[model samples]
Target chain A: MTVPDPRFSLNQWTTRHWPIPDLVSGCVARGVRGVGLWREPVAEYGLARTAKLMGDEGLTVTSLCRGGFFQEKDAIAENRRAIEEAAELGTPVLVLVSGGLPEGSRDIDAARARVAECLAELAPYAGSHNVQLAIEPLHPMYASDRCVVSTLGQALDLAAPHPPEQVGVVIDTYHLWWDTAAYDDIARAGAEDRLAVFQVADWVTPLPEGVLTGRGMLGDGCVELRRFREAVEATGYTGPIEVEIFNEELWAMPGPDALTLTLDRFAEHVV
Target chain B: MTVPDPRFSLNQWTTRHWPIPDLVSGCVARGVRGVGLWREPVAEYGLARTAKLMGDEGLTVTSLCRGGFFQEKDAIAENRRAIEEAAELGTPVLVLVSGGLPEGSRDIDAARARVAECLAELAPYAGSHNVQLAIEPLHPMYASDRCVVSTLGQALDLAAPHPPEQVGVVIDTYHLWWDTAAYDDIARAGAEDRLAVFQVADWVTPLPEGVLTGRGMLGDGCVELRRFREAVEATGYTGPIEVEIFNEELWAMPGPDALTLTLDRFAEHVV
Candidate 1:
């Protein structure tokens, strides 16, 4: 059988129940070479231990899940800790989910401005840590309580104030598939060198309660996965394609089983 | 008490359980001079009969609920009938919810293309009937199963090929409050004279199953309802402000009580 694409990386949230050690071993056993980690799991496993585990398994840390929630009271300090974690793990990218509007405030502009301010304070720290801060524009449905950055254009705008290597944007299919200008924005992201991470997750209907978990498995929904992958590749991005689905079913499966299935689907729909 | 604004129109779907007759009397009692209608109820109550009832009550039909669902096999014929109904009811606008991708299909581009083609066929007919086809871009959450058009910008682009008087866009606060580019698009719509209808409904979190009917009461959610009204007015749109909410709790209220509550909230949050 043909091997999985070397650039295919499994995001920790996809198989959330998978223990860190088993996840590493599962990737190695399946010939997977990269992983996108979450800060909580890394912290839980002990940052040093998680980094050593990846090294032992010959796995590269493709990215760290998130760092930006600028609306919080101590956003800078929290983000600094996240940046330190990414640096220690040797991950080049730190995904940012800019928080939603501040409580009881309808002033999205102010909240967005806060994100910019927090970024200014953290960009230098991230640059020094050698981690690229990847601002992820979530789906507009989350604009109220999750992330106010709701378009690739907005994400790129947020990243523009920083150095290309210092700040970038993530292209996640689940959050972006509905955008009519997504293709144009994707091209713009590539041209501006702001396309820091490429994430894959299909969007399914009847979005579950809270609209958080319930992402469709690869090829299970309407997203044109191959087209997105092709677009990112055309932009000269030779980086890991992180499968970051947050479905309950996928998390409930045995870690090895889920990895194997993901590899197969990745080969079929994404790579 | 101050009289309710004459431009405030109640969309039938907002108080869904209220029979058409009760809805009419309720509006007339409240001095509500206009009503937005849904095709199913109008048909169930007999279209011509409903039209006559509105005329007899001296209430105007502001707009018709929908026309486009182009993915269906009979979409063209179906939309033609809707245009005819709007004309018969003497309403100037027929809102269109461009249907989502075909079942089990991953071709959203094709679905969107179908909507444009359907419009190309129906726009002239609608114009001939003295009805403008107003494309309502549903929230992105419904991009897969409900409507492929997810942004006001996209709707405006689709309406661009037609005459402004023949084709226009619907500005729904619930669907668009989260968009960063919404204000600019509103100005563009006004400048282009394509802002055919203005709708208002507050957004609440933890969207109920299907994400269709969880709209918050006007003052119950975080949306800047008055700001949206001002924005639309700034666009020079002097059309009726249609309050179209879809919430189970609101529907369960007595018809007159719901109307009273809506008027109060409209004044408090949207005036």
Candidate 2:
């Protein structure tokens, strides 16, 4: 029988309250197929230790939480380190959060130029490792202090000069659901086989913490999850739509409770 | 002598600390000739009352702050009323802050479509009154709650099917500055004669209210005002580069004092 809706994967960030191994185990107990993890936790658990845990617990990593920030005057050394980490995790796609405007700089175009240059320099390193870079266009609020890549189309353009298999985009419904060209961008990425990862989250009300705390739990906000999912699926991306909400309230809840809610919401609203 | 920076104007929301009349007198007092004003104070002062005040004070009403909540069911009626007020104010442009995702609705595309349809319907009404409808692409932070139009490129596309003279964009630095395509959009807007209003404000720390406090006090934030002015001017539309800041702290300050500071920055950084 065809799966009811699509399978739901959980990013540890949504349940940041739990330990990484516990998050892995908790996800498995709840019938979650995959987990998106961060480098620091993996490093803390030791990549070998975490990979072992994921294997024993039978958890599939949807994608790595991120690897980007290719800015600054000399960023080669930093990017190389990130690449090595992604390779160690053995995740299929390494999510890359393109960083924001540098402090004391006013020219975003110049800053974006720096990102493009960094990507070109790091492309060979990323290529050598068999790691794919997924450029996640963050919310525009973070545009000043976070990622400068703000749209899927812009991300596609940045990826154009590089090999699509090497560099692609991560479509988090939270970051891109509001964009006018979101559907078109996803279709184009899928057409080119550069639709690297599918991330799920919601844009919340009252927009807490201004920048970070405001991301809603999937069902809490108004993003059309089914529409967003359909758009990605239409792009021929058969990958899992990972739930990656960055919420404080959800974090305070018990990990299993959050996981249960996430799964339920995924089935009810998204799937 | 050629004006050093002829495109500069003042958006009163920047120095929101000041009363509208004080902002008007201050704009003239400080050699800043154009102004973008919100409706609340105009309503408080009465539109006819404020219009003659602007004329008497020799201030150019660059654009009225807004005239679109185009997503609501009654958006046509709402916008018609807004157009009447904008025309009454004698501002050549009526800035439209597209309302956010309709609460409880998961469909962003549908909301965006509604906004577009509203614009299409209002375009004629605005044209008849000689009020150019300026679609202000709000910061993406507001995508779910406020303006769904979140990029200059998106706004341009929304305005594309309409005549540039009748429909255009409000290139507010606070909103469009974070967009990766801001520069290209600015240049493109100018090329198409759709640069309706060039607003200035600093992207400050998100305030306690969870909104971008409109806190950029001219030189206070990282917006490249000079370069932005240069880019807009290059567009061949020598319209007012209005300083439109929405800072609460600035609003708390005495309006005249805020005006004084706004003018000083306009001369130093903008002009």
Candidate 3:
């Protein structure tokens, strides 16, 4: 078998049921060098232990899953904690899924404003931790109950005020592939020096209920993965390309098998 | 109870199973003076017969359901026939749900280019029929398999190359609500005189599978219906505000009851 691409990083959520210890071993067995981790799992696995384990296994923590959700009452405090966690884990990036509109509220403008405010509050904290806050604009379907930030353009606009070292943007293929302005925005993101993380997942039809957890495996749907990768690379972004599929079927597979499948598809469709 | 808003026009798909005759009589009884027609039901009831019936009942045909599916091989010929049908039905507006990328195709740019080309070919014919083709951008979630046009800005851009009277854009709250630039685009649509139709359907979450038929009733979701209506009116658009919903629950309700609920909600939440 061909050697796995050096830039390949498996997002922990891709193998949702994979135990932390086994996942570390699986990555090591496959010669995978990086991992994108989630907060809940790391907290459950003990942050220091997870960090020590990754260090022992020689696996780099590419990023922490999320930090934004500004609509929540304690969002600022929560995000500060998340920033500290990222610092402890040795990840340079903390992905932010800025929360959706407040409950029963139609004032999306207000919710978006809150995200900016929260970001300003957290950017300095993140900067002190040496962690760049990567604002991830989710697909528009998640605009109501998930992230109000729904396009790369919006994310860049929101990140504009902060220093590039403290604030940046993620270019996730699944969420952004459908946007007409994505490529243009990708170039703008690069020009602005806001390219922080690059995640890959395909866009499949008949989105499941709640429109979450249905992200297609690499090459299983219609996203132009390689084109997206090339676009980011063209922008001079040589970051870890995290394979972040959130499909039920893929999650059910053995972690090693899933990683094997993802590695193969990554080579075929993304690299 | 307050009389139904004169501008409220129930779209046929809102009551999918309601027979044309029953729907027509129900509107008249409820004091609703306008309706948005679907080509399928109109054809099933005989287009000429339906037109004559609406004329006899003194109900104006607000707009024809759709005409553009540019990806289909026979799209041009089919749209030409649709223009004729709109003319026969005496509707001045034909809404276009531009189809998604051709099957298995990842070239969205090419698919979008195809839409522009098809519009150029059909605009003159629609103009001749005294029918304006309104480009209706579906929600971005539908960009893959239903409609590539997914924002009001994109719709207005597509309609820009043609005469405003022949080619216009639709403002559907459900599809455009999540867009940060929607209000600005609405103003642009007004200044350009390209606002052909104003449609309303609140956006509720946990979208069912296929994501096609889960549109929320007006006051039932987070959309600021009155703000959207006021924005459209600010554009100097004195056209019908078509209530176009596609929910399985709403469709299962008895026609008159569904119409009653819609009228009540439109008054409470929209006008």
lDDT of each: 0.92, 0.79, 0.94
Query: Scoring only the second chain, what is candidate 3's TM-score?
Result: 0.99
Over the stretch A168-225, how does candidate 1's per-residue lDDT look in tens digits? Answer: 9999999999888889899999999988889999888778888899798999888999
- Stretches of candidate 1 exceeding 4 Å from the true structure: none
Find the candidate with the highest lDDT and give its number: 3
| Candidate 1 chain A lDDT trough over 10 residues, lowest sum | A1-10
**Candidate 3 per-residue lDDT over residues A1-271, each given as its tens digit:** 6779999999999998998999999999999999999999999999999999999999999999889899999999999999999999999999999999888899999999999999989999999999999999999999999999999999999999999999999999999998999999999999999999999999998888878888999888889999999999999988899989889999889999999999999999998
Better of 1 and 2 by lDDT: 1
- What candidate 2 gets wrong by more than 4 Å, as runs, is A1-6, A72-74, B1-8, B206-209
Work out the TM-score per prediction. Answer: 0.98, 0.92, 0.99
Instruction: Score chain B of each candidate by TM-score.
Output: 0.99, 0.92, 0.99
Models ranked on TM-score: 3, 1, 2
Name model 3 segments beyond 4 Å from true. Answer: none
- For candidate 3, the iRMS in Å is 0.8
- Pairs with backbone N, CA or C atoms under 3 Å apart (clashes), candidate 1: none
Interface CA RMSD, all predictions? 0.9, 1.8, 0.8
Report lDDT (Cα) of residue A138, candidate 3.
96
